[model samples]
Target: MKAEILYEAISEINPKYIEEADMRVITKINPWKRFLVAAACLILCISLSIPALAATDNSFAYELLYTVSPELAQNLKPVRETCEDDGIKMEVVAASIEGDTVNILLAMQDMTGNRITASSDLMDSYSIHMPYDQTACCQLEKYDSETGIALWSITIDQAESKLKPGDKITFSVSEILSQKEHTEIKLDSIDVSNIIEATEFTVDPQIRGGAGNFDEDSMECKRLLLPEENGYKLCDGVILTGTGMVDGKLHIQCKYDDILNTDNHGYIYLKNSSGEVDEYYSSISFWADNKTDSYEEYIFDIPYDELAEFEIWGEFWTCNNAPIQGEWQVTFAISE
Candidate 1:
């Protein structure tokens, strides 16, 4: 947005021209046609700094001018970049660069059906690649249910002033999730009233990380439950590994498969016979098997005699393991 930045961006343009194939065909362009195109580009560039004009929609010429003289590039017409896959179309609508940040606007539309929704998410499956080291994040900006179109905003920032005007940036998404589902599960099979303290416990190396009053790093390491039997299935891709009383505390462990991809996860707690959940509970999470499979253990300080009046309850988010997978990529340069 600064004049120095624009100068640096336009300085990369090469003014020289070389003869190419079909030169005669290219020279056939009428002077009037060329004049009209140039006039249109001049109007567009002049409106670039107009807030009202940009509020509606506009394209920056920073990338387009990188290959020609500043004068020619300033008058050159802009082209829209788009890609389609699996009945879906993705278009790079607008982009801009400000100091150490690059902002991009993208639009996606379902071509054959009304599958695109306001709840759709990239689910951390999107990537932005730049010539320099940077951090990128995206969020849904808007959605039109009637048109099956969704607009997303992506921001890429660098720790230092590494972003340049003509730098090529590629944005891609590999997976998309829609129709979020959240449910509460009741564990009626587990007789909390008859729960007994375990004699032996294992120091589960699968413990990735956790938080709570339970000092996992010290204090004799209050033990993890042993895989005694096939545990209760809380939901799809989620299992209640085991439950036991450990050192006067109730420990409830649950396993989730392919958490990185599916994001199938939940929290475990207890509800009274009147179906009221006690808010005083803490949890620690770890890798049950590997990075793909995760485990979370909830601990409660309730007395053993009072356990019977409480029932185990779980609240989970399941995407039905349904993700639309395809390659959607757009490459363009940031402009003022």
Candidate 2:
């Protein structure tokens, strides 16, 4: 009964106060609400073994309130359940249900070192297990450098209207990727600036997905030399295959080997003299083989004469090549 009142009082806290609480300010809440918040914090301090708490600092209060309030818990809290492996900790910070959709927030923290960065992402190797049939997607919401924590949001949509409060769901991840690097494409053999028009050097690869003005009917897959020979090593698992002026546009092609496993892919951009990226560009992706070899073509709308003023830049990740593989799973109940 006390937990219920504490939950209600915390729930009544102004949303604005909750936002300001991030800055460690506790204000405008009534005396009773403030007392409940303090009492909840005391309980959590004992339950979670918190070392200390500042009376004026309410940043921790928000998390404490989540323990008592289920609906509010979906946003932030240190859940009771956690799995730690390979010097990394995975915890279900929050879980709640809205209508037929269930949203779960999971946090991954690197305790031993700084391996978990802002770019740390799941390698499409995670799975969600629930009793009901549902479709779920997991995405990295944000990372806090101060606490060495990265939060991921998982949204699950039930097929039928069968989901309710207090239903348990299991979230699991097999691998995590970090240390994403971005670098300039420098070739020892291929001179990108002097590449002439070579529309004949194009090959038709299996289309996967694309962006920009590329037509689906006219799939323009630019063929390039094999990475084993003429390819320039851009990063781990990614290679620069070809560069040429196809028609009036500049075509930069890259090969992603073992794409399905590594999640090794990147963005190609042209940077000008002022270090500003050219936003107007189109790209298409295709598979040399179904799951093993993937190729991406970046088409830039610029004249060959101006190509000398621009440098090729790429943001790539070979995440799966050196992934932190572990079985991190957590079962948490959602509240409506």
Q: CA lDDT, every prediction?
A: 0.61, 0.61
Off by over 4 Å in 1: 1-80, 95-103, 131-133, 155-166, 184-204, 207-222, 227-229, 245-250, 268-292, 298-315
> For model 1, which pairs clash?
none
Per-prediction TM-score to the true structure, in the order listed:
0.57, 0.58
- Least well predicted 10-residue stretch by lDDT in candidate 2: 23-32
What does candidate 2's lDDT look like per residue over 1-336, in tens digits?
664344334433433343355422211222112222434433332222111222224334334434434344333323446889889988776556656656666678899998888777676667665444576556555577787777665666567546666555556677887875444464445555687776455355567877667676663544432223468777777778877776678887788878666667667777777989784367777777545778888888898888888777776655544678887777666665
Q: Model 2: runs farther than 4 Å from truth?
A: 1-79, 83-89, 97-103, 109-119, 129-169, 178-193, 199-203, 214-216, 222-228, 289-291, 303-309, 324-326
Candidate 1 on 4-101: residue-level lDDT in tens? 45544533332111112111111121211222243443333332211222233332323222222233323222325788989888877656665555
Q: Give model 1's clash tally.
A: 0
Cα lDDT of model 1 overall? 0.61
Query: Lowest lDDT 10-mer window, candidate 1?
Result: 17-26
